[model samples]
Target: MEIAVCRAADVALLDECIGSPGAVSSHARRFARQGEGGGTYLVAWIDGRPVGHAEVIWDGCAAPEVRAALPGCPELNGLGVWPPELRSRGIGGALIRRAEELAREYGRTVLGLGVAADNPRAADLYARLGYRRLTDYVDRWSYEDRDGVIRECVDPCTFLTKELPSGSLDVKRT
Candidate 1:
């Protein structure tokens, strides 16, 4: 398997892998802005097919209130492996390892993210990868679409962070 930086073309493929239009659009924007310091996006490919994807973000100085309440750290924004079929085959772990490598390369000493508190599997995966829960918090936000219907969604998010070993990645911290 090969882990490589994602290009704009990979956005569609990634959306297919995750099976969500919202996730696809969000990630598409992230990939497009990777070159501008939004963060890095990568995909794990097996036999020329993408099997997993990861995203690492550094919010620079615009740290949102949600992120500021805890601590300012490299944020592992999104990670998704293709559904049921390839899960538990270690693809997810391999993708995470790549994310950690990139995080280190970006010169970030610590990484953090908000995960759904109800998802034990995801929480366990992060824990196994050295991430520790820093706070229990719920993020609430509302949005309106073209149809003018306002939808409110609350995510039970937990903030987790992991410190990188010194010199683990080649980049220098900013």
Candidate 2:
């Protein structure tokens, strides 16, 4: 299995893996905006097929309250491993480690992320990966559904954080 930053050519494969063309485009746009105020999108591949995805946002883009609480922390967002059968195969963990590596590259010491409050399994996974719950947060956002109708989402989430090991901070813009 190979885990790396998503490139232009991997977009369609990501869409197929996640079963959502819209999501693939959304992540691609985020990646395009990297260094211009966005983040890195990573894809995990097995046998040349995409199996998981995640993004590391330099800006937390959280609510003002949450932002104030987590000053200087970049967020690991939009993490997913697809096709039910692919769960527990370490793809998700590898994607997360890639995000941490990118965070370290940006000279960041603390990495933050929000997990859905109702998702205990994911929360457990994050905990095992060294992320400790910092605070409760709510994410309010809107997006277009498959039918092209805009829908609002208000997710009750828990903010978690982990400290990266100190190293030669290499600020690579990829």
Cα lDDT, model 2, residue 47: 87
Indicate the TM-score of model 1.
0.79
Q: Model 2, 3: alpha-carbon shift in Å?
A: 0.9
> On a 0 to 1 TM-score scale, where does candidate 2 land against the true structure?
0.88
Worst 10-residue lDDT window for candidate 1 reads 18-27
Compose the digit string of candidate 2's lDDT tens values, residues 1-174.
788878878876776667653322565565676637578888888888888888888877567756888886888888988877999988888888878887877788989889898899999999999999788878897767667777778999989999998776553322
Mind giving the per-residue lDDT tens digits that candidate 1 earns over 51-130? 77777777622235546655557676667777668877777777777777777766777777777978889889888888
TM-score of each: 0.79, 0.88
Off by more than 4 A, model 2: 21-24, 35-37, 168-174
Best candidate per lDDT, number? 2
Give me the overall lDDT of model 1: 0.71
